[model samples]
Target chain A: MQRLVVLPTSRTGWALTIAFVAVVVAGIWPVIDLVNRAVLFLGLPLLVVWSYVLIFACFAVMLIANRVIEWQEGEDD
Target chain B: MTSPWPLLITLTYVAIAMVIGLRARGGRRMNSLEEWGVAGRSMGPVTLYLLIAAGSVSAYTFMGAPGWAYAKGVAVFYVAVYLAYLALVAWYFGPKVWQFGEQFGHVTQASAIADRYQSPALGALAALVMSIGSIAYAVLQTVGSAYILFVMSGGMIPVWLGVPLVLGCIAIYLFVSGQRAIGRTNAFQGVLMLIVAWAVGMWALHNATGGLRFGPLFERLLAEHGEFLTLPGAGGDMTFSFWTTSIIVSMFSFMPPVWTQWMSASSARTIRRSATWLPTYYVVILPMVVVGFIGIFSLPDLARADTVVLEYAMQHLPVVLVGLLGAGTLAASMSSSEPFIHSVALSWSRDVLQPLLGLSDALTGRLARWMIVPLMALVIAPLAIAEPGSLVMILLVGLGFATQVLPAFIGMFFWPRASRLGVMAGIVAGFLVTVAFTTLWPHPLGVHAGFWGLMLNLPVFVAVSLVTAPADSEVVERFFRIAAPRGLTRLGSGGKTVAADTAAHGG
Candidate 1:
């Protein structure tokens, strides 16, 4: 019988997943707690900037990580 | 007394599209299926970026976005938020698919899946599902274009005239130049639509509140229709549940026939690089939100919420701008429809016909090209007769298909042990659960049924894969080596030599 083994998560992966979850929670907490206030003072502009920045950062990180992994792998090969 | 200028401009655009398609025949020798289907996989970064962006933003962006905003206030921002994540997901998943496509000479997503899994049946099933979903999506685009024409002509142009005319143009272009036609037309439409959207938005904002700033407009909207601007209060339609479901639906926006454009990228890096800038295209939709905001304050008593953008443009903007807006909306509809027509054709020809009949690539490609006209007729004819539901509902149904495919995609990427059985079970179970929840009740708890289905699908997929023995080790390793290759440039090169060497003597 083949042994069932769980793969270890990489540090970068763990950190990224945690950071993404944290940002989402932080963003949503205020929306839940202060609905109207959030819309007026924080939500609109925050959402607009968040839409652009977060998406850009996410793609940037993925691209960078892929490139780094590929570079390292190439060196090893 | 309708002006002929708008019709003239639109006709000119169509004429130009046809000219590009017909003119493309002279430049290149079409020897192989690749040239016919994927433009020899020769797209550069800029064309790739524009094509991918235009493929994703459709009539949904032009009319549906502002319509949703007019109907559902701040909740519509979820669409933008979803688009952001969709690009990110594409950034991650797209490269691997592109790598596989390059290595195996894959022409469609199903081709890659079938090749990796060694299952023709799975590939055929995927093709069937995507084809049905794409036709539904194409029909929606056709209907949207017709609706726009109906609005622009002030009912002079029949709905029947709108669908056939627009679809006829799309069919002719797609049949003539294939991906080349789509790429050039998309780039043209993408730029013009962005300019026109910005112009209409600025003009609407200026006319409504005397400037582009949102301060005055926001205050006015709050004073006039406070509830519309915020989440629904008790007993209102925009409950916590609806908001959560909307978010979930938004997440699956990236996984459709439209995303087939990502699969056809010239290289993995091209796909990755394009993902970075595609979200910036979402800025084009910000104008729609502005238009919706104007609608709320300016025309509070309008009966149908979906007409807010068009109605506002008609009343407030100059006639020339209105004409431009009409052209822009038509561009949005056609931009989406043509690619979808091409994708559905590819799905049928490459995925279903070739596998089932063992036809040559050339024969299949010819069949695919011929298939577009009939498929266009099939979609447009029905949509003209019976107007489909709201664009949001149509979009959600499309997302449901994506959700069904998500488990399979996730398994293929991250979980090497995930068997075909596991994948199939997860898809079937997830799809049924989503349908049951979405239809039987207002999605269990607050979340969208699709999200819950996805949430359930992952675990079932994992458990089933675990229960089943892992797939052949060589196959799994080959997928990993291709997906996360040791040498990036070597990723798509066939691993036949490696597999053979390993087979002769164990690695």
Candidate 2:
């Protein structure tokens, strides 16, 4: 139990972890430069558009994580 | 000459905030450290949301962020990006921290770290570092609050008077209502700032572009000064490495005021819910950044970049809107200041003085209240009054120092092999490296000095832990049970495994 607690024991946990890591990497690795040319996407700069997209991604990931936790807690009950 | 109407409206706003804060007491006597420091752990998701959101957005959001946007174009978007990432961090870590607090009676981060490492002295060290950072930050906010009033009042209020006026209101409610005051006032402040941010943004867009739209503004900006639209910004100073490293440092560095907010949650679910929704609140930064971009063409050649938003507003907006802007900025300043000042006092009493003297909880709570006055009047107020130019630089270094706690956090939450000695060595070495790079060399090779410090810190931590003995397995397991509790039923069940608990219950 102790070991599994530290590492993700379930597939959902692993998927969330990978998604979160991808988000962090895309955020800080100059990946935005690929889309950072002097152009607008969705009425804003591409870089700015990418930032809000990441924000939306973050919200989606956390929402899923929270729902999983709720399900796990209910199962325990 | 500036009209006193703005000042009068701001004062009226202050009076309303005071009423809300005092009324947040809700007829409870805040006697214990748990009650006062963390509002008896009764805050729901909404209140917690407002408290954390408002406290995180400070005078920086009002002034410095826009200042960055005015000076460096896309680089300022890093604020929005990192802040969004911070919500993800809070989502992951906040629940675990709340569980530790609930299980072990840990109101302060230092106490939790101390218990995890079995080192009161390390807790003392954390308390000192966190307090210095908190106080320096509070001083900046106090100075900012005073500056807001001084500017909005056309210098009629003066810094000396404005400092006490803003800090004094916080102190009164903090002394009486404690975290409850912060929770309520922050909610009011959060709503106000959000409204003001959107209102000011739309108004600026309408007046400047002759229409209420951002497309034309972006077109004009890209057409005229295209360099400001991308990375490394207009001056070509904020490189990609610098931008990325800054976001990483700001995202990971644990602000102690935020910890107290986490502990004040009613349940781990509340913490998770609040963190999940927090990124949406960061949309407020979009308009404020727009206001900064508006300044690029509308009011150019500003001597001080930070004053661009205020200067533009005063020059262009009506008296009522200007007054609303002043109230919103003041709310931003005071909302953040209250929690920081309260945490400094709470940590000093509970983590520092209480442990050193072995004082009772009641006495510690009393001492925390007493310390607030001297903390503000003697330490923070004086430093803010001096307003030395170097303090901002020092504040930045203090923030850098905070990221050094990452190793200790890892030890508490994961990596059962992490030793107390290893954590201590890593933090001390990390802090020194951070100071050296930030002060002496300053962001060498375009990477943030704090990131460099962490680079050295992780290896040292691993090396020391490999050599040093690990903590007791049973105690470590107990912590894991409480922190993760994946298969366990409840946090308050004394760390029992589900199998054993079910069998013991005759299942």
Candidate 3:
């Protein structure tokens, strides 16, 4: 029987969790203020681009996390 | 007669939506609460995706978002930020929620929480509090639909007439079909809204800059309105603190309708996959926000910024496109409202009335189905007609109230030491603080009232739990065993094994 783990077991899962939190925080205040400028990056404002970038960053982290979850499920099965 | 085309097209769309919703039962019997409340928990990923995405987008995307963007500028992007975070939250929590629901016959969020803490009264309390938020949102969407029809029909369909006409149709379908109706109609409405958003966006871009390109228009906006591109926004009222804190509050708020959507999914994998792809659908918001930015140039100085999109469409777009935009707005409003309305009925009957009155499951389901009419007609529709002040403010305040339950959720999902008394106290304290901050102080120290509420709630919860006796160990263990069947491992410490000990086993 698989033992109940209170947190993610995989190193990648831990790293991804931290990274995802960082990415979300980066899209908001204080950290976001650094990039919240009037300048354009690839046709959009820097702040707007940063928000989109963070969104994709979150997607990437979650996708990897999904893989980890599936791997764990495989072990359980 | 003001060309009658826009009104005709919008009415036709409403009729089509009603047909879709009524037919969604697929000739199956919806005799039980499970079938009506959550589609028997059989929703596939595609429909779940649209239901969640469409429900979250709401009339706010069409009305409130552009209103904020037009009036405040870059500050409006906060909507996009929180929306992405909501997807991430669902991905993390969805599987656990689904597991518990499958194992323990949980059809509502309150039911799950109630089961975990072993308190039906707590469940009833949560149901009452969450209903407040759900009602506020439902009314907002109702008002939005009425506004769209009013504008589209050149005031021929007044707010009083329009509110009943459209909502009445949605009410009838919901009364008959339930979440199956919500699933089908959301998918249809989701597609229609996306098309309308893109069409309206591209047309606006072309008209504003003389080409179908955002680059030139954005450059022009930068050159002319530089302040709009940065923090504090055009209005400077949406401060950095306010913006960031609002996102934090929104990301955690346990909105009842969203929980129902999660429970409706076919599997944990379906929920995860749906959450994974839901972010991409938020691209719909971009075009709508752009339409607002376009408004700054095309039709500046509009009273009530929510009307920017509709006003712009009427003034600039072709008649057919205007009608299409009207249909799309109605879709956005109805798609969101249906689920919240459904959730209110389900939560009330199952979580509150059932436990209090000791009603049977079949009877509860029947009551929930019938409850939709009186609630919508008597409560929700009348509020919408009253036209409550500031859609975004109403939404934010509702979220503030809803997020008070986060402490209870933390206990259920993570901390076995957390007791029922602790959670109840925390929610009460949090609610009081939220009310005070929102009304009297108003974002004290520039932080959101919801966050401020959490500030008081967390400590009270931790302190109370530490000082008091913990919950029944058997109940806690049962929840953990199902929710984390493979055992949840610890995060950080390089995936090191810190013994879960009694905590894992629910001591």
What TM-score does candidate 3 reach? Answer: 0.96
Local error of candidate 2 at B29, Å?
A: 1.2
Which prediction has more favorable TM-score, 2 or 3? 3
Q: Rank the candidates by DockQ, best first.
A: 3, 2, 1
Q: For each candidate, what is chain B's TM-score?
A: 0.90, 0.95, 0.96
Colliding pairs, model 1: B245-B448
> Which tens-of-lDDT digit does each residue in B204-282 have in candidate 1?
9889878877667766666666665555521256565566556555665444454467656778778777876777777
As for DockQ, the candidate ahead, 1 or 2, is: 2
lDDT of 2 at B211: 90
Q: What is the Å distance of residue B488 in model 3 from its true position?
A: 6.1
Real A-B contacts recovered, model 1: 0.09
Task: Please give, for residues B1-507, the per-residue lDDT of candidate 2 as tens digits.
Answer: 268878888888899999998999999887788888999999999999999999988988888888888998877888888988999989988998898899889999899888888888989899899777788899998998999899888988899999988888889888889999999999999999999989988899899989977889889888998887888898798888988899999998998888899999999999999999998898888888888999998778899898888998899998888888899999998998899899999998998999899999999988988789999999998899999888877887888889988988877666666778999899889989999998899889999989999999988987897788766666566676655455432224444434322322322
* Stretches > 4 Å off in candidate 3: A1-5, B390-395, B486-507
Tens-digit lDDT track for model 2 on A1-77? 22121445467777988988888777876686675678877668778888888888888889988888889889888
**Looking at the true structure's interface, with contacts defined as alpha carbon pairs within 8 Å between chains A and B, what fraction does model 2 recover?**
0.41
The whole-model lDDT of each prediction reads 0.68, 0.85, 0.85
